[model samples]
Target: MEKNKTIKRAFIASLPVLAGYMVLGIGFGIMMRDKGFGVLWTAAMSLSIFSGTLQYVGVGLLAAPATMIQTAITSLIVNARYMFYSISMVKKYKGTGKYKPFLIFGLTDETYTILSGETPKDANENKYRFLVTTFNHIYWIIGGITGNLLGQIIPFSTRGIDFSMTAIFIASFTEEWIKKNNRKGAIIGVVTTLVCLLLFGEKWFLIPSMLIMTLLLSIKPKREAAK
Candidate 1:
């Protein structure tokens, strides 16, 4: 009974993510179709790459056919912040067995936010977390495949659909900002990103911005402690 209840709650919590992934995934699929990839290619990429922003970027990479080194560098730069996320989860996922790999694989920003905020009241905490993460991943995969299939049949323009990923990022940031009581951290993030965007432009600013923001935010707690 408790297990079922946990699953139910996890499912409900995942609804907003489901809606977002579907729209973004559909947009990606439309792009893939437009780029001449068939359903199999779309499904394979969706299943394998699985990182939402990276998957969209991967489409361009695939078209251009980057060397493995370049691909690795690109992936590392984009996903380096995930290392910090994994650090926080070290304790939460400590005792997970074979499940550890799957848990790590599915630890997106949204999954981490949802799971980290929830205190597990049930004995099957790992199961609950796993289900939630897996459920969200399946939502993206299903959405991507469905979108690719739809792209073959639908004839409308997909020009601005790529912006869906940007919308998702904004929504995620808004949610995080609302839940956080620490004004210092939020201010630092905004200021650092703005400055970096101006100095480095969109293409090269992300890593530096994130690094500086992390450094600044790390100091906030220490300063507050000293106060």
Candidate 2:
């Protein structure tokens, strides 16, 4: 009974993610199909890699004759933000036992937000977290498969479809901006990103900006505590 209740609650919590993933996954699928990749490829990528932004970027990588070393470097740079956030999640996930590995594997931006958000009193927290993770994964897979199928028959342009990933990031940023009482981090991120863009240009700004943002955000909280 308790397990069932936990599953239901987790599913409910993941509903918003369901809506977002379905759309983004479909967009990714369409893009992949447009690139001459089949539904099986789309399903395989989504099932295995499961990083939305990376997968979106990966379609281009797949089309190009990029070397394995080049792909590895690009992936590291693109997913570097995970390294920062994953540090914080370490404590919260400490005692998750058998669920720890999958929980870690499934830790996407959305899953991180849900797991870190709130927990119910008396609920089996690990179970809840696992269910949420699993549900979100299934959602993405279904969406990817569905979109690939749709793309095959629907004669539509996939141009600009990749923008869906950026759209999700923008929406998430906007939401965080609204909810947080401390706006310094957001301000720092925006300013640093713009400055880096101008200085480093579009192709090279991301890494430098992220490094600066991480440094500043990390320093601010400690200095405040000292005061």
165 Cα displacement, candidate 2 (Å): 7.8
Taken over the whole model, the C-alpha lDDT of each candidate is 0.78, 0.83
By how many angstroms RMSD does model 1 differ from the true structure?
3.4
Task: State residue 155's C-alpha deviation in candidate 1, in Å.
Answer: 10
Which regions of candidate 2 fall more than 4 Å away from where they truly are? 152-206, 220-227
Candidate 2: tens digits of C-alpha lDDT, residues 1-227 = 88888888898878778877877888888899888898899999999988898999899999995789989998997787677668869999999999998998888988887686666654689999999999999989988888888845646665565455556557667777788835787799899999999999987788788889888878858776685
Give the Å error, residue 220, model 1: 6.7
Where does the lowest 10-residue lDDT sum fall in candidate 1? 160-169
Q: List the lowest-lDDT window of 10 residues for candidate 2.
A: 159-168
The positional error of residue 102 in candidate 1, measured at the CA in angstroms, is: 1.2
Q: Per-prediction TM-score, please?
A: 0.80, 0.78
Give one digit per residue, the lDDT tens place, for model 1 in 94-213: 988878998898888777777766545663777878888888889888888888887556576656655555565566667767887566766887899899999999888878887888
